[model samples]
Target: MPKSWPDQLLQMLLTLAVILSTALTIFIITLPSSYSHFQSGEITEEDFTEDDRQHAGRSGYSYYHNHRDTDGKLKTECTIQIVVLGDIGRSPRMQYHALSVASHGGRVDLIGYVESEVHPDVQRSRFISVVPIKPHPKQLQASNRLLFLLVAPLKVLWQVFSLYYALGYQTKASKWMLVQNPPSIPTMAVAQFVCFFRNTRLVIDWHNFGYSILAMRLGSRHPLVTLAKWYEGLFSQDATAHFAVTNAMARVLKKEWAVEALALHDRPPNHFQPLTSIQRSTFLASLPDTAKYAANIEDGSWRLIVSSTSWTADEDFALLLDALVDYSARAAENERIPKILAIITGKGPLKQYYLNHIQHSKENGKLPNVDITTAWLSAADYASLLGSADLGISLHTSSSGVDLPMKVVDMFGTGLPVVGWSKFEAWTELVQEGKNGCGFDSAEGLTQLLQDLFGDDGQRLKILRQGALEECNRRWDDEWMPVAGQLFQLKP
Candidate 1:
């Protein structure tokens, strides 16, 4: 009854099998991975090159950029390294270029500020690598930037050497180095040296002739400005290829600076999708009750005027303020005019100063007929708000007289038509009258255009918004591919 001899033998065999399986599982689970093996003293890390271990035991960026091949070899496939001295957040141009490369399954080695991480969309690729620059002597100090410009060459030379040594330690023979200009005088000089040492071809993306940009903050005839211009023109000769953001910029580079350059305009990212009404409502909700119609834009009763600014001097936020006040005063002359909610979005050098001034103006009964709010939103939030707005207003009238406004490009990407102040030479090429939107030369003209654009019936507003969305569908990566494709061929 207790089980015969044969049954007892079978039960014993089953217990033995269970014991063996348990032991085997423990052995496999405890086996060392690359990192663990290296740590445990079993694997000699000296045998594997530094680049091979580059991705090991690192956080967000380096983790994705690991160089382990299937055979456990440390391998790096990144041919071109994009270098920007400042934060990628500070330069959407650099960010977009790196992201575009990642999307195409091409590996990227990006060197920039610590605050920047690879944008989420590009994280899909395991090939994206980022090397954060070491902290500067006094970067957080507000006066550091002014000090930087004065000691520009020295500060930038230090950075170049620092990154060169760091890069030399990690990887070998990076084929090409694409450098962003302005901080141009220093960047071009530093990049040329780095490329020479690394044996990488140097390419410059001239966002603007650096001297023109420097003249905006520093005086046009200041020694530093003159020195910067001369040096920029001098060092630019070393660049194998130059990319100008506008045709006018390319012309200036060729005729004035005596450097051959090509025009390759900027474009929005692939993920800047058309915003739906629901998404717009969600983004508007993130704003305080004072903005975007007190979070009650559902009825579309109050006209929502949205503008994005970088808070730079050249952008001239004062122009938008003047136009807003002008329109408000005109509306007050007639009570029949519609109520308005003006949303100005962005953060920058003058952001806090302007925000306080705006609040003070409203409290003093200065902006009585209109409510204006500044909403500093994430990139995603910004795109949503741009798409939701009745109209966008661009204050950028080209500080350099050549470089086009990326803010306007972003607005157009959402198909949110904009009424922009004209730099005639630059803005005229982008903002078409009664097509994408209108352009203005004065605050009074902008005020008049705003009223005409958002008329009580919203008829013309609908047409402009639709046109914006259609234009938004134009080339992003494809537009830049021919230029980027050239990088693959430019060896030595």
Candidate 2:
């Protein structure tokens, strides 16, 4: 204890070095492997060993078994689960589609972070059931303060670990899984690879071009854009099939991946049927604001209907308003200014943006006659309103050249001539310049197109209102059910 200063200093330095070396050795021994089985695209008996099985069970693998079929062939039929993961908002289309597929004998399970109580109709639907998984309380609150202080770093770490776990589980579980709008591409890609490795099939339903939208909304350099692109690549390469909502989307997928993607256009619920003229009038009459707006239209004035899930820069609602103003100006000089009215339905972050834009336009004398109203309506009621309208409007900016707005399909279904931007390849293919609908390059172009339609009622009347409906029936029929049936590959 009473040693010289030199001896004491040397002894302390040696002890510190030994401690550091031991800690480094332990870290290396305990670290998990970063080389993912899914990334490598391989599966082996070791993947299904006791250790792997335990890992899979912990990561939400719900079913497992080993057996042989009557043919003495070693075959396996694990539960094929389709997981629809996203925010369950007011629109129930996702729920409806899932239930319909399940009712037709497909195996589907909806897994979502439920923020509100499940709708009664949704609960009673044919899908096995809706399962609620709560996000971490902190993560649920996506505030600026929290994002910078904590969420971002944690998110990156979570993505890395979650992907590692999901890939292993997917390999051991069912051979097929449908993931709808998964939050993380790394996880989704790993899961998909695992399925592929096990002779499983994956179908990626591209409901919207999320990456392009995000890139437009936030700068292209945003981390989310890179992540989305990575996932898109995985979906493009590994998926057995790809489904897009619009022909525009189909073209985009084909261009990007050189794969022939299937376009599964959205259909009205199976129960939806066209209403009679009298029925349509009665439905519109029931809406109090509809009556008020309808009465504002003077005789010989054009009444227009503009509706969407939400009015956003993407929808180009501003362009629609501008065109309406231009049309009114032209008509005013000739005593033909149509009493223009707009009905906005649905909610989104851009709700206030649209409201302010409309208010500013009216104050600036651009849309003095236009009236904007918002409300919630059932699908049938919405359809009835569109059917009673003189014209229907839909639009998108240049970035959305490949997006086929479902509203166009709805307009076509209702026999309403649609006037909107024409960048979509599908629109150009399906909509004749002045036949079923007309596309425009700009607000002014759209206005001129509208003027032509209003001036010649006879010609407008002759254009096939039923053209869109016929196209829908021809292209997106019950044929998908057979492709879905192939997933089972069961003997009859």
Candidate 3:
């Protein structure tokens, strides 16, 4: 049956009306208080506590109340306490950045959740202090583990709802509340009003857009996106400053939330002294089985190493695998087996998946020649491995921008020529193609680049031995220190 034009038009209008009504309903029902007068830039601990308690009954307020230090008076009058509600595993760059700020004479306190054990070296790093917070049990489960997955979101939602209501009910204040990878909704809900409070500077570090991750995970649009959008709006309207690791993220922040955010280029801290050849070899000798995979590669094969946590989906190592297969096939004609290796370090939900995928490929003859290894390595061990690699790789998805991968920085510090995708703005700026390293837009381009470098031994050796080290020293300077110092103003 053919529908008439008027009938089709009427149906379309009805659908549009329903969507508009739903959106309006959400706005009126879920919107938190947009307090305009609380614009002062200084606050006391008591005031922050009082506000949270007062707002305990509100629908969307959540508060992370830090108890007052009773042992001694606040020694540093202008000490900045930056509370980051995220995992330590995913925040090495932040940790180093905080250390850099502290090195430049800013008193910095980082509050976050860490695993049961802390690495000794990480504990000894100067310029930063870590305060441990309790992590939810569900966070320990693997990403593919379904038992925790079914109930985790619900628990997170309830926690967020409770926290939001509590914070809104009391009006507890802070000088600055930077929610870096908060676990759930209520934290963001509370953060909205914290921005509204006169003395509070609300900063949301958009690490990986949680809403987008959730969308990809569930294969559907979750209601949390709507809530996140509302908080994003609140931050946009009232936040004193907004920052993202990459320009692409900044673009999303501006387009979706109408917030103008600065792209803060993350650089490595200068504390790590250049390891001598002997010291570097000694450090590599102490690494675990998986961490030392790079050492097994023959001298002639152009080895490419990727050092990152297991869970980062944005790395796109699959492209690297495909490219390696292609490289091997081409090299075979010249009586050569392309001796390329990929070493994946760190642990996360995707650990097993990555392992299984790689193992299956090798077993099924898809990637017969390429050697793939995965491991959970400490920070020091990972750094040592980076020093051993000939070339580093940092490939991110479209959503990423000029985020200088900490691995890239470590590789540069070790004088390894980097071969990676040209998408990340920071990489493009730091790595001059065929000088210190090479960048490409496609797998074929990268393969060809690798072939060229492999064939030209002299040029490749120059980059690996000297050019990259010079680039690292030149880039890791004091220009980015101000961003860390700015955290001090948030202290009460």
Candidate 4:
């Protein structure tokens, strides 16, 4: 059926109306601020609590508003904002950015959701102030596909208003804004809008392609996914600068999006360093209801394996479970192979499911010589555990093959040898085949590698540990400062 001339004219008129409305909104955003009355930028010494001061002093983190040189001139060069669309405590990369900025004499206004306990260093830093963003009420219902489809727009709208108020009224004007990009839909667009009006430079840190992640659920050819890809491409083009976790991701941005991005790899912070023998024993003693494992650890009869995960789709703990089960059966047949104590730490949606699976495997007598324990440890405890472990295992298979995992980097930082999942190209950026760590493609391969590494009285493990120790010297500050030093106008 052919449309009438009047109908065609109506459609064209509606399209024109949308274009005009968009232009009007952008024009209004560019105009001078009549909204200054709502903004508050003053902060006094009394504004900080006693506990905050103690945390800062304990961590040796300091902040100053103005300082005079010998000639009595004031200097204030660094003031920036770090925005995260997810939980502030959970996002370790951005937290590292805040620490680096504060250490470099920058005042950071960290904006994000305050759900979990943040790192002690970040919580204590005098130069960093956490600005909380309220999550939409429907956050818990996000897992239900039906509910998510119904309220996704409302959730975005809520964030839009929340971000506007947080950027405009709650925090002070800043020179630059660095935002994470997985939740790019509202974040990238809203950040661009804020930076446009405030005359602030915006930097998008590309952890992964948002649209690719959407494709995991919605599929690649879905109209919504296509629309999301277009939206991400549009908003990302205007960023003042960009950062990527891997060189491959940076190349993708350049070739596909025509945006140049700096490749900034994730390195463990200073707190993730290896612990002393005494410190390791002390940490082990602090754990509750693990006296058997602790006794074996002291006797040097059992080896500890540490692994962490979010229990998400990208990480398959079941692969690790299968490898452990096979290792346990082999160990039961051969007493020369040391007893195994595997500790997996994290909290997530699939945790209970994996717990049941582990119990079932054990009840079936599939794991005779392996003891598996799951726990959620504090940041400091987690570091100590990694440092004390004989080995580390990583099951993260990246959603986008170009993105690397921070968990592997953390394991390397703690001088622990890792056996990583090697299905992705980005894994090569962190794991060297027989150097600092090993990579495996399947449970059988991992089981065989574990036997080879540990069977010879840990002769092979020590060499890998030494290689991992070599990586310890390359800390977060070392990698971060070089690239960010020039971008940010900070003065020491």
Name the best candidate (by TM-score).
4
Cα RMSD for candidates in order = 19.6, 10.2, 11.0, 4.5
Please provide, for model 4 over 281-374, each residue's C-alpha lDDT reduced to its tens digit, 9 standing for 90 to 100: 8777777635558878767678888888988777889999999999998888877778788999887878999999999998999987888999
TM-score of each: 0.78, 0.69, 0.69, 0.88
* Candidate 4 off by > 4 Å: 1-75, 144-147
lDDT of 2 by residue, 1-492 (tens): 699989999999999999998987865575333332243222223324465355543211122222223443332232344544445544344555454454343334455546544444455433234654434445533435435435655754555444434333322344555665434344455546556544556666666555676566566798768777766665667677766666777877788767576766665443334557676566656776577554443233547565665554567777776777787677766555455667777665567876787788778877655566776666556767777676667765535465566666666666666777787566674467666777787889977876676666635644645554454443222534444444444222
Overall lDDT per candidate, in order of appearance: 0.69, 0.56, 0.56, 0.83
lDDT of 3: 0.56
* Tens digit of per-residue lDDT, candidate 3, span 231-322: 54554566567667667677777787787876765555453335676765565456554335435443455354555644657567667766
Q: Clashes in candidate 4: how many?
A: 0
Instruction: Kindly report which residue stretches of model 1 are placed more than 4 angstroms away from their true locations once superposed.
Output: 1-78, 116-118, 139-172, 286-296, 489-492
Candidate 4 global lDDT: 0.83
What would the per-residue lDDT of candidate 1 be over residues 1-492, giving only the tens digit for each residue?
699999999999999999999997965674322111112111123443464455343212333334334554433333567777777665778777776665443446777775644565433334456767765565433435577566665666677666655444444446667888876745677677667655667888888777887787777998878988899999899888888888888888888778888777877766566778777777666656334363545665567778878787778888778777877887778655665788887667788878787788788777877788787666766777776777888887676788887877888888888888775476666667787888888888888887776545677877877777777877567667777655554211
Using lDDT, give the best candidate's number: 4
Error of 3 at 207 (Å): 3.5
Q: Number of clashing residue pairs in every model?
A: 3, 1, 25, 0
Lowest summed lDDT window (length 10), candidate 3: 59-68
